[model samples]
Target: MTQSEFVNLVMPFKDKLYRLAKRLLVSTEEAEDATQEVLMKLWDKKKGIGSYRNVEAFAMTMTKNFCLDRLKSKQSGNLKLVHSNYADDRTSLQKEVELNDSLEWVGRIMEGLPEQQKLVLQLRDVEQYDYDEISEMLDMKPTAVRVALSRARKAVREQLIKKHSYGIQ
Candidate 1:
């Protein structure tokens, strides 16, 4: 692929790649580096990239693997899993505070979930990937993806409810 073609193909989902990296790595700088590295890898392989059936899925899988590997590395001892993607400009100050608190709680709850469930939740809920795409990226069956997403959502919901309902009696 020519440089323009490669740019056209990859630019659209580059933010998605960064978002996934940030979700896994919990550091903006690390996520930016990871996205750049993945983009560079794709550019280097641009000659044969057209042969792939779904380049976006391939790129997402690459980003996921790269971030996971980084997390497992010795230098990742200080890295923590936290997400902060909620933003709404129209809400009142109090509403925004409440929303931030709720999202923080959800992030903390997600941190306690299994790695698979966290990935499933991030892909399906945060990134808005479909079941088939998530299945391909994560190497899971579509049904399995659905089940994991369901369970992850249920777990987050239950925990949030429990947290809010505490001391209500």
Candidate 2:
């Protein structure tokens, strides 16, 4: 494909790629590098890109694998899960503070979850990917994706409720 065509195809989901990378790598710089690397890889394969039935899914899979590999590497010792990507300019300061605190607690709880559940939760809830897309990216069946997402949400909800109702961490 030509450069413009490639850009048109990728621009739609580029943010999604970066978000997934950030979710996995937990560093903005690392996520940016990963996104650039994935885009480069896709550009190199532009000649055959049309052959893929769903390039977005392929790119997402690439992003997922790339970030997972980075996490598994020796240099990943400093990486950790953190979620700070929320903003609401219209909200009052008190509301914003409360929202940030809740989000922070959710992020901490998510850190304690298993890797699969974490990934499922991030893909489904944070990234807003559909079941089929998440399944394709993570190589799980749709039903399996649903189950993982459900379990992840349930765990997060229960933990948040416990923390709020009984003052337990």
Candidate 3:
């Protein structure tokens, strides 16, 4: 691929790649590095990239594997998972506070989930990927992806209810 073609192909989903890396690696620096690494790898394989049915899914799979490997490395000792999904720009102060609190609890709850469940949740729920796409990216059957996502959501709901009901952290 020419430089311009490569850029055009890769540019659209670059932020998505960064977000996925950040979601998994839990540090802005690490996520940046991971995104750069993935992009470099893709650039090197730019010729073959065209052969994939869905380059985005392939890239996502690469990012997921890369981040998981980084997490398993000894260098990951300092990494911690954290994320907030909601924004407060349009709400009243009280509503913003409550939203932030709820988002914080959701992030904490998500952090406690298993790695597979977390990835599934992030891809399906946060990233808004469909079941087939998630299955392709995650290397699982579509049904399995659905089951994992369902379980992840159920776990989050159960934890949120428990926390609110019993005032437990």
Candidate with the greatest lDDT versus the true structure: 1
Which lDDT values do the candidates have, in the order given? 0.82, 0.81, 0.81
Q: Which model, 2 or 3, shows the larger TM-score? A: 3
Question: If the candidates were sorted by their lDDT against the true structure, best first, what order would they fall in?
Answer: 1, 3, 2
User: In model 2, what lDDT does residue 156 have?
Assistant: 89
Tell me how far the alpha carbon of residue 52 in candidate 2 is from the true structure, in angstroms, after superposition.
0.5
Most TM-score-accurate candidate: 3
- How far residue 158's Cα lies from its native spot in candidate 2, in Å, is 2.3
Q: What is the lDDT for 16 in model 3?
A: 87
Query: Which segments of candidate 1 are over 4 A away from where they belong?
Result: 75-100, 167-169
lDDT of 1 by residue, 92-130 (tens): 345534555666767767766777888999898888888
> Which of 1 and 3 is ahead in lDDT?
1
* Candidate 3 Cα errors over 4 Å, as ranges: 75-100, 167-169
Q: CA lDDT of 13 in candidate 1?
A: 97
lDDT of 1 at 147: 90
As a whole number from 0 to 100, the lDDT of residue 151 in candidate 1 is 92
| Candidate 2 deviant stretches above 4 angstroms | 75-100, 166-169
